[model samples]
Target: MMATIVKGGSFVIDSSSWESIMTPEDLSEEQTLIAEAAEHFIENEVLPHDGELEKLDYKLTVQLIRKAGELGLLGVDVPEKYGGLGLDKVSSTLISEKLAKGSSFALSVGAHVGIGTLPIVFFGTPEQKRKYLPDLADGSKIAAYCLTEPSSGSDALGARATAKLSDDRTHYVLNGAKQFITNAGFADVFIVYAKIDGKHFSAFIVERTMEGVSIGPEEKKMGIKGSSTCPLILDQVKVPVDNLLGEPGKGHVIAFNILNIGRFKLGAGCVGAAKDAISLSAAYANERTQFGKPISSFPLIGEKLADMNIATFVLESMVYRTAGLIDAVLQNIDHGSDAAGVQSAKGIAEYALECSINKVFGTEALDFVADEGVQIHGGYGFIQEYKIERIYRDSRINRIFEGTNEINRLLITGTLLKKAMKGELPLMEHAQSVQESMLEPTEQSDTDERFAQEKRLLATAKQIFLLVGGQAVQTYGLELEEQQEVLARLSDMMIAIYAMESALLRAEKITAKSGEKRGELASIMTSVYVHDTFASIERAAKQSVAAMASGDLLSLQLSVLRKWTRHTPPDTIRLKRQVAEKVKAAERYVVV
Candidate 1:
């Protein structure tokens, strides 16, 4: 496909290959050992016990999770002072990936650590942290977040649960039921949100031992059965005033922000599962013969493998970039109790759009990858014995939980528009700066060629946003959910473009030091990323713009958009094979 060009900017092609950009990072001995330890634990401890745990045996589930905590895997992202390893987000994501190889057992651990405990670490009071977090961090006690009720799934503020302050003012009387809570049977601590005064919400840290607190029988789910999921019944339970998580009427803050972190971790897990799915398909294709030869040798199978690799790569790139952005925001700040910590909220709040974007993309991408994985395996993929079968079922919840992807789509668009309105996004500034930085071309190779393509795609995407986003917001407004979908597509186009731009820029800098071979490969991958991403943006822009139109302009613009089909990327099959080979060789998902 021919490349699209920006009017005021152009790509400076440097001769280099993706190999330079794709060079692996050097890990410290500790990092390597930690990852290996996680892998070993999953293969040995978790996989063997998957059957019994899947039956909802609370005792066995808690024991295994505690064992994981003992291995220091549960507290990888927790601070040292809080009984955690205080590792970086990438490392935590790696741990998540490894645990995912264990299937739902990984999910069990994730529930206890990621969504369940992160809120306390990020937003709890000193007393609350000291009271509940220590046990949670050490795995002595499990934790669960209670947000979804019988009626409140995505519309959290629509919750009917009530927590009325007692006449004595010492405790709050809670009367509500939270359904489909993970770690329900095992959690000793629950972060429950309840309405106060009929107009406001509050978060309360309730213990299982509290009076009138009970757990319902486990609900049989479509997947992730190993993780206990049941209802938390709180009938006139007495929660002390001290147990209130944050100030009254501020529970939405905790619910929304902690959920952002959960979405990222969920995306990371999807990446891990996608890798496994891809590997399974690739290996099966190589071994299983069809048409008198291995299926892997055929273009059809090759295309599927390529598509899987590209999807995985895009997701990993986006996930890590989002993580790195969040890490940057949370880096110097202390994530302890104390209201002073809230003063630094600007950092994390700024990236809400990015977080939601990753959630939507990662979940949807994994779903696509899983479906394709099954298709690649043909009938074998559908059978229960095949891990893909389980993975396909397990993957469905990611979109539903942590805010349904439908809600997340609204968030992605709303957040982006909000940011843009507030001047936080500066999409134009980002575009201009990237173009300026690449004005002077360096050298040339295969990787450099790819880098050039990535730039072209990004530049085109920026243009589309400038033209389309403004038109939609002015015409459709926020009330129309379809506009939100359009905004989501626009944001995705920008995100993919940004990822490619960043990776290409990094690859160029890396190549300058690593030599041409590595540089060439990085460039190739960058181009591959750009090509795939641009095509997506082009399609979305065309569809969205046409949908927004009321008159003949719709058909006219679509026809024009179709005429520009020369802008798509290279054969994805070959590009994905290259990506898969790297993933298999490293046994992990990575961009480089």
Candidate 2:
């Protein structure tokens, strides 16, 4: 099958070679060793202190972060010149995934490595990097990102913070309150975004010792309480001119580009957290007996476990595939070049759609895994003593973090449309082809019988998406921005499409490597995911078409959608049982 992808504002998808993408199964020996080290750190340091960390022990949290830095876990993406390991995106993703098992401690490290430090790594000046990167890399200085204000959450540009130039042009006086600042209570550095003279939006590096900089009392939260979340009060804090990050009035560039990286990393973290939840839930089921057998022996409980494993598999596949794609693009750029920062940011931004898709899909998948885990634990799941309970709470914030799932959904379609408008992606042309296909009888394409049905369903899902999405775009034009519900539905279809494709490709790769017999489990899981998600794709497409069209037009579109979506539903019960047997035997997620 052919596909188009936008990278660095250009189309880079080669139809004939489109199937080549990385998967978790491709991890190298060295990468595996790095992941093992992170796992060891989590087991030795983070997990043992879970209780103390939960009690908001800021000192222990800082100590843990420093320990991670000492172990080189905090500098996976930073350049070696900056006292970092300067690893690839995949390695960084692996670290994020492993750290996620640490629970709230993972959030502390994630914010530090992602939003907190990337601005300097990606956009800071030579002096800025020289002064801060070493300390950040070595964990001597902890960092926090101050973006959301009480008045601004998703509307980040609406921040009330103001920075004014001093009379001598030596410093900018910053005044504002940033709410829910992660790592606020203990972070030594903060990436603050404030409007200059209440006009030009910008970002600044503010030190904890700066005059008039103070953190409010930590907010008692629902989840991840081990990580500090507080309001930062900048009461006429004077930040030196040298601390300005990026260019004046161009803070959004940093804010957004860094967020793209954060979104994918957040997805990777979710994958790790989901795996942890699956392991705990499966172990609990194996131990807890009801009637004559363990709860895991029950089909209903087994089904839940199977579903969790399946979702985690798909999420892991997508996360690594994206990381590999980003890494491949970034590897070609010289990190020391003057324009490297811009090039790097563009490289990451190239897959903004995929990043947002991963964020929305991975977080929701983790939430599902966590919820089912709690369900499998029954009453024990609700008790704080149970790890599942804390996991349930911790998973809640992911949807709202990076960007709200809603915002990310909008971004998914919005970015695709922008790329289409810029001629960077041929989405419109593909949509036009789908529209044309609807006018004629369906034409069959040859494929290996092993995945023929899935391949066909995937193609149809894309058609449904293009049909509805194209109609919406044409009907509303620029006003399509207001059709958020329709746009969200379209985003759902795209998310499902991407998820299914990732799983299918991974399964195909494994099957090719190990043959059909050895790859049976992957084939089963992929089939289950693709078949089930195709139904969801059809539903979302139909809903979008219904909302955008009416009467005869809506009816006609629905008919065409049905034609494309037609497929025999697989025996998912049998598939789930097969998946469950593997998961049960392994005592955890075993797709890898």
Candidate 3:
């Protein structure tokens, strides 16, 4: 039965199955070389122009992108026939991670390659690919995606942008405005979404030379100022009928599928940026002295460094695990086939729940990491002269990028329910199993002593999710959407579960290969993460159950939660101190 369920590609409800998933430790030599090349490019080409790029020098930004293109960085996921490197998802994730250290320059490159060009790569006609991909892949032509309107942000399909067919039916007259358009100021190609006849929501490929298309002045932003961000205006712009992307009335397909990929890539980029923050903070703590001693020696400062590194490790593990799953699905896809684009989209969409989880978790984790990075720099953290200050500012937008973290959180639970309803995931069945287990007698679980406690805690965490989530669904039915707070709590529980599982699996894999001697840090980090995360899950589950039920029912549910959550709390103070010693000694993040 489990094998049959596994073949269906549903969510892995069983904890034992997670070990089969790939981890960052599984990256092949070729993939590591690609990652190294990306790091070298950023260090040599991007960091040197940091100031010029931040000043909004669009020309310098364009030149740097072309340089990256020359090195095949822009086309990691594109098919070779389309002038791209045609690498797997892991390779693409690696490039995104490495380039993240470049700050605003990374945003520029990411937007162009992700939302801007991917729509064409995955949904455009054969002629469209032949015409635009070569230039996009090689960075000769820049691209931007136009989706958001003043009236519609997260409600994407509510866009007011309209397209009317010309008398000859040979062209579309586009009229509307797209706000906060990334790469808008200098993009040669634009993937614009508009409704045709005021009803059929669709996407169109509009070029810069179009007569009625114009770009607004660059909007000054609190962060990511170096990346061109402007409103794109379309006043009776003439787009060829053939320029329609995907099928008419199916623009949501392109919009959503592209956004799915965008969300995961954004998560990967956040992990990279967080790693940079960890390194910067550790180095600063080591050199900055307080009270005649290095700050890194202080327990409080060491605590901060340890927390930052722990979060980074968890995030890195989640991102690569997701990338590996995406690649596994894509491996069976025939890239040369006509259905390749649609098939690839389906492959990615299969993990929509996990992708949303990654997006929300990774961004929020980076925000915490960046805030600490700034704090570790002391008063210098507040000034622009310090790199941590800029990183702090730059990190703010990620929460709102690729759909706001709030929206992503909502999507996380929403997607899971939809899958459950469609029989794609056995969420309800797993919930029932958890309930049954709760009713059974508690037994002394015999397991691997090394991770036995953490593993049991993980299982209980899943039970908490099932108990609270299952009750929420029963109480509200479809109206659960109105219970935003409950939904958010469930989402947090799910996020913690995913993070803990990823960390545990990664640490287990490492320990199995290198033994306790070399994998000691990994084990410590995993234990620390799971211990804290389990507490958080317990809190979220209690809050959610209380809100959903009251009086005796609430008391009963809370009792069950306490039973499941009971565990010997690891000495996190000592664990963090130990983790921090290594971080301070290495002067950077060493556990990765």
TM per prediction: 0.86, 0.97, 0.97
RMSD for each model, in Å, please? Answer: 6.2, 2.3, 2.0
What lDDT does each candidate get?
Answer: 0.71, 0.89, 0.89
Off by over 4 Å in 3: 1-12, 16-19, 444-448
**Candidate 2: TM-score?**
0.97
- Candidate 2 structure quality by residue, lDDT tens digits, 29-109: 989999999999999998899899989898999998998999999988888877888888999999999999899999999
**In candidate 3, what are the lDDT values of residues 1-592, reduced to their tens digit?**
1111122223337653445667778889999999999999999999988999999998999999999999999998778888998899999999999999999999999999999999988998899998999999999999999999999988999999999999999999999999999999899999999999999999999999999999999999999988999999999999999999999999999999999999999999998899899888888888998899999999999999999999999999889988877887788889987678889998898887788888999999999999999999999999998888988999998888778888988998898888889987788988888777776666545466888999888878887888888899889998999999999998898889888988898898888887887889989999999999988999998889888899988888888887777667879999999999999998887773
TM-score head-to-head 2 vs 3, winner: 3
* lDDT per residue (tens digit) for residues 3-95 in model 1: 221111111112223332221232356767887989998888878877787677788878888888898998886667778887767678778
Native-referenced Cα lDDT, model 1: 0.71
Give candidate 1's error at residue 370 in angstroms: 1.5
- Candidate number with the higher lDDT (1 or 2): 2
Clashing pairs in 2: none
